[model samples]
Target: MLKKVRTVLDDVLDIERILGKISQDKANPRDIIGLNESLKCIPKLKELLHLEDIKKLNSAADSFADTAPVVELISEKLNEEVPAQLQQGHVFREGINKELDELRKLASGGKQWIAEMQESEREKTGISKLKVGFNKVFGYYLEISKIHQDKVPETYIRKQTLVNAERYITAELKEYEEKILSAEEDIMAIESELFAECCQKILDRADLIQINAKLLNRLDVLTTFAHLAIQKKYCKPALVSDAVLDIKDGRHPVVENLLPASDRFVGNDLKMNVDKSQIHLITGPNMAGKSTYLRQVGLIVLMAQVGCYVPAKKATIGMVDRLFTRVGASDNLAGGESTFLVEMIEAANILNNATAQSLILLDEIGRGTATFDGLSLAWAITEYLHNHKAVAARTLFATHYHELTELEHTLERLQNHHAAVKEFGDQIVFLKKIMPGPGDKSYGIHVARMAGLPGSIISRAKDILNHHLEESMDQSGTSISPEASKQLSMFEQQEAKFKKDLDEVDVDSMTPIQALQKLDELKKKHGL
Candidate 1:
């Protein structure tokens, strides 16, 4: 099937290029030839479309009108041995116009006359330096040098004087010059008019020709898609008009091609729906295929919508109205916006415009700010996306913030999934596979060691991480050490002082504006 498609494409002429020539202000003979050649291919292409594998191509080709008459007229009228330039003549056929043919013959014979005159004058004057010259400004002239000036003839009428020579014209030379120039000019004018008439004839059927050109272009693209499908082993995805998207053993089309044969791509299954799972919160360590999984789903859905087969074992895609991706971080520093600000702006655009049928891919949504602030924003955004009544867009949210994994328990349509990894003592292997549930831990130190960071820095980072985790557990009502108890006591004292100051405010006798001023003073005094 692919071979047959390629054979048809080989016979297809670039009809668009021909149309471009026909639409030019001054269509040349080469343009006519190009149009004739393209028109001849229409019949062959139409015949090839009869194959069973090319039903779409046949439908498009059937609409094309037979332009054989136009091709015949151009081929018969225009000369096959035309020059690249139109001004050099020989553009029209010999029998197209009698007067133009006669003019060309006269122009050809007159060139011999000029050459013969050059020799005849040299012998008659007995001055070997005497010559005949022609230019646009001076039609024709006989020249004699200063050394031979005494040999000048009486019938030579002085036309002009040169620094070292004299120029003269004869009555015979003037008569021939007029006839040759007039005939050449008339021949060019007649050929141009005849070519213009041919162009107008082609333009008269321009609408039909344009229709055929457009259909041929469509056929070419469809044939190309068929070829790619066969070469890549892509399957036709089942497209449905529902809210469910299911794909079994889906692979990233571009990544698979770029990988070496030894490192085969690991395909993953994806299933999402508006009611069951609208948002999949992905948590994993860096470079663990989280982003690749998100992008693969988006690409598969897009490919299916374009009427092309998708790179998947078995796939079914529902109609998606709009697709939005906020995968990477970028800053508009020149525009006075930080990375976080740009992130928020894009998030706002997605939230405000997305519909229930939209597909959204968000990667590390809030990683530009402080830890608690970023975690809080990511948590809130996930909740809003899952629970928003008007916009329940199917979302794949990839984040390094593990705190987001907690949302799965609270949000009904939100599910937790992570890229699987294998652990070996202190070292870990990235499986590059998606699985159920949140990741057990983020092996940042292992990743840093793999990146070749200094051992001392890695050691210090591990110490700091352990300390923070311990402090977090102590603050959450776990057994506290003496130093943590001291910090907790200080916090208690500050809270007590704030409450006392609030209780002392006398709002009953104060004006509303005065009460605001008094509250502001108290807040500053207590460091609230």
Candidate 2:
């Protein structure tokens, strides 16, 4: 029944858009016609739904309204061929009003009126060659041959003198021409009044029409979802009351659709539980589908609750009351607070509002601030979510801060996942696949190299990284502390500043004594 209904409803117009255009006092002919046509589609739906074969399904037909009266009223008055605007005047059936019909006839028959005037004037003047002519330059004129110039009356004003004839405009011709020209305005005035009256009749039943519009919209959305589910090979998700979100081979709906015909989006699997695996700590490098993985799980859960098929091989979702996301950097409009402040504010909102039933997706949560501050906040937020039951929502957190992955052993409910990457010497490829366990490396410099950075900058960055690693890590590189990393980072910053100052010294411009004094100042500042 729904398949048949979906096809018939293809003709249903956008009644909601049409209703928005209706004026309080004016009847927009175009909008009214749209409303009428949309309502007319209800009968087809009613016929399909009012089936006795299934007897119990008859209740669905009761949802529709009897919009026939509105449809009939609009059809009776609206012209088959409408003008672009009401003032242009063909918006109604010709015989709907007597005055309107008379005005239309007068407006359309101006040529016949002018032809009769020429005959009457020829009889009156006895100029056999006299003719009534009209143009933009000399409107409604009497064109007489130069031979009959003597017969031109004092009442006739010579508007133009031609090569072999004279054009004259008389008071009578001007008076009759004004009537003919004003006939169109009169016709429009009548049509406007009639159109307003007809619109009022329909507006009196606006409530019923609006109700039907909503029902039809619901029907349309369900049918579209049905068609897409079949076309995209989506699966119906199972709903559970407990705290678990399990999806197998789930794909991102938007990214999948946007890929080329030859390319297929790689599907990933996710399973979470409030008691065992409430939080999946995602660690991956840039552009390796971490964000896409986070968004897909959240979207699939949402789709299941919203009564639609999800893009997954199989899904069993715990209903989510609130879905909170802190995915990217954004600044406040006032500019008083920094972007990091904005990130904290959003994080605060999610933390304060989210409950055990909520779903939270945090992508690179601490990337907006200093590394120490960011890592601290990311670590503490994860602990707060795990320790506090009130806010212990199912979370999918993606970050480049690999240190946070160490929390899986500390937090009982936290699990580790990464977007897998493959490296060949200096080159790395984002495999676009999610896999279990924490990532081996962030590959930041490698990602920068892939982004087309200059070779010199890339080489310098690698040198700085290696220097930091050597200074901060243990000899085996198996035991590294954040405290040592912070100290080494400060030392690196100070060293770079001293190097910049030494490189900027002007030996050619400085006197010997002043150069000695500058060297003493640098030695004192650097504790040399």
After superposition, the stretches of candidate 1 with alpha carbons farther than 4 Å from their true spots are 11-35, 51-61, 79-93, 98-196, 260-263, 330-342, 367-374, 421-430, 440-528
Runs with alpha carbons beyond 4 Å of true place in candidate 2: 1-4, 23-27, 50-57, 115-153, 158-168, 474-528
TM-score of each: 0.71, 0.83
What is the Å distance of residue 248 in model 2 from its true position? 0.9
Please, what is the whole-model Cα lDDT of each candidate in the order they appear?
0.84, 0.85
Clashes of each: 0, 0
In angstroms, give how far residue 165 of model 2 lies from its true place: 10
Residues 1-528 of candidate 2: C-alpha lDDT, one tens digit per residue: 667988888878878666656645544677777777788888878788776566544665787787789989989888766766788778888678888888888888888988888898888788889988878766689999999988776887889888999999988889888998788778877887888788778778878888898988887888788888999999999999888988999999999999999998999988889999999999888889999998999889888888899999999999899999998778876878878888898899999999999999998887788999999999999999999999999999999899999998899899999989999976798899889999999899988876767656777787799887876657666756757556657678888667656645655568999999999999899877
Indicate the worst ten consecutive residues by lDDT in candidate 1.
499-508
- What are the clashing pairs of model 1? none
